[model samples]
Target: MIFAMVNVLAPIFAITLIGFVLGRSKIELHAGTLSTTVLLVATPALIFSSLTSYGVTPTMLLEMAAAAILCLSASAVLSMLTIKMFGLSMRSFLPSLMLPNSGNMGLPLVMLAFGDEGLKLGVSYFFFVALVQHSVGFSIASGSYSMSHLLKQPLIYAVAAVILVSTTGIAVPEVVLTTTEILGGMMVPAMLILLGSSLAGLTISDLRPALVVAVSRLVIGVLSALAVIWVLGLEGRVAGVVFLLSTMPTAIITYVFAQRYRPEPGQIASAVVASTLLTFGCLPFLLWFAVKVLEQS
Candidate 1:
């Protein structure tokens, strides 16, 4: 089990470490451009292709979506309660705990560990996650919701169009399909590199708040996902994906949102880096546990 887990994780970490090394060095990367391309182009393309591909059923998609929504909602509620109980500021902490880096880290790990079926479910879950992030999450961070921006995202349109076509049994053209697959293939590695680079830009100025938030986020988030899985009765690869996503570090986007709205971007940055570093110690056990539970189930 140890050997297999390491083998699966090594490649993923290798790519991320390369990005970290580059980020720490004198290399200059156009982060905004890379981020834009991944979010706007690669991600949507990946979503479309994965949804339209074979072996993805409406039932599976529905279950995955339900699990993701429940998990996210549960996380949000738990975070609110934690903030209230601990006297933490809502503006600074809620956003960090509410969002997970499921796209950049979750997707690639699922694909590597769980294979095509897992990727299919991961993409479905990520689709809803991104939706929640753009809509509800952005609203919370900005204190206002803009319908225009949400409507303007190509991801929404892509998801809608793909689901419509997929359910209707409409066949996409070979040329278009092939192009999407080729482009979508770029999503995972690109995201891994971006994650590493994003981490590179963060620093741990204060350890106390960072540790508290990181530990609480992981604990509450995992507990929420486990509760959702029990309530929803999800199992096998689906259950595994939910558990894995729940364990993801606080998203770097949390720091971006904090920079804009909250006064403590520094603490948020610390939490982001600290939580991500915590993953190295936590992920192996979590991965093993997921596999064992799925097998038993």
Candidate 2:
């Protein structure tokens, strides 16, 4: 388990660290362009390839979709409560509270911890989260919901294609699959590098808000997963996937939206950095705990 964990996490952290160093060195790499490449090209291909090859069952897909919806709903409610409690304005509240970085960080962690089965679940969860994020999540992050923004997400297109192929029982051509694989393969390393570059800009002032977001994500996400597991009787790897994904740090997209629209870009950026750093410690411990619980059951 430890070996598996290290194998999965090492590359992610390593590439991210490299990106961080490059950015700090005053390199000319454009963060926005790099991020756009990942989101628009690499990640979509990865998502399409993973979903097409996974051979997910209808029941499993339904369960995962349900779980994703449940988890995000809980997060949304909690975020609203937090915003109210803190008395933050609408401009700042959405970015700080609505988004979690479930893709770059959460998905990789899931694949590491649970392998292909977990990857399938992560893909479904990613879709649901992306859907909600674009709709409600966008509204929160941008202070107003826009249907156009929701329609434009790359993951949405990928999910639609995956579902279409899945329902039709059509196989992707080898040539096409190979091409996507090559592009998709670039996702993790590229994302990690971007993460590192983003982190290179972090400062001491970023720590406090980051701590707040980290604690909020950990406490609320974990408790929500536990409640769902208890109420719904989810077990084995599914339970594990739910718990880990719930605890993922605030996503970089949150920061992007904040920078574009929210009044608290600095605070949101701090949250993303803080939550991501904390996940390194929190994820392993959570995995061990979930496994132990599943064993006893």
Candidate 3:
């Protein structure tokens, strides 16, 4: 279990740390271009490549999607309770708490922990998380909803295409799969570097409230994932993927949303940094438990 945990987590830490070093060293990397490439190019390719090969029927895919939604709903409800208990403003904190870092931090962990089949399941979980993040999560953060923003994401079409081919029994060409698999390979490591760099640039002005939110996010995340998994009777790779993803740190993007649309951007930044630090601190133990205990569940 110890070896498994280290094997899974070491590359993530190293890649992210290199990004942090680059950010702090004042090197001029085109982070925006990289972000766009990941979003528009790599992400869609990843969705198509991994999910198309998932080997599950459309019904099973829908079941995974439903499971993801249940996990998110659990987090939202539990997050609201945490917010009210702490007297935090719902508008400022709800989106941040409800939306975990399922993309950058999540994919790598699942891929490493459970291999290809796990990546496929993790992609399904990520799809719904992204969907909710753009729709309901965006509304909560921005105080208004825009269908336009969600529609613009390429992964939507990517997933749609995957489902179309999957349900219709139309086999995708092998050349496309190989091409996409290559492109999809870049998504995780690039996102990790970007995540580390973005986090390194954030400044946390206050520690107390940040700690409060951080703890709440982690605790609610684990409890919510467990509750959902248990209630749904989810087990094996599906359960493991959902569990790891839900327990990820508060997404770095929450600060971006707060900066653009909500108040307390600085506080959000603080929470992002604090929560990430705390999550990583507890991750070895969390990983251990997942391998020793949750893996069998």
* TM-score for each model: 0.96, 0.90, 0.97
Which scores better on lDDT, 1 or 2?
Answer: 1
Candidates by lDDT, descending order: 3, 1, 2
lDDT of 1 by residue, 164-206 (tens): 8867888898888888899999999999998888889889998
For residues 1-297, what per-residue lDDT tens digits would candidate 3 score against the true structure? 678788999999999998899888869877778988998999999999988866656776787788788878888998998888889889889987888998988898888888998888888888888888878877888888899999998989998998898889998899999999999999999999998988888988878779988998899889988998899888776777888988998887788788998868999999999998898899887777665677776
Off by over 4 Å in 2: 1-4, 204-208, 295-297
Instruction: List where candidate 3 sits over 4 angstroms from the true fold.
Output: none
Instruction: List, residue by residue over 101-210, the lDDT tens digit for candidate 2.
Output: 77777776777667777877887777777677667766866667688877888888887788788888887899988888789878767877887888888653556556
Which is better, 1 or 3, measured by lDDT?
A: 3
Task: Point to the candidate with the largest lDDT.
Answer: 3
Better of 2 and 3 by lDDT: 3
What is the C-alpha local distance difference test score of candidate 1?
0.84
Which residue runs does candidate 1 get wrong by more than 4 Å?
Answer: none
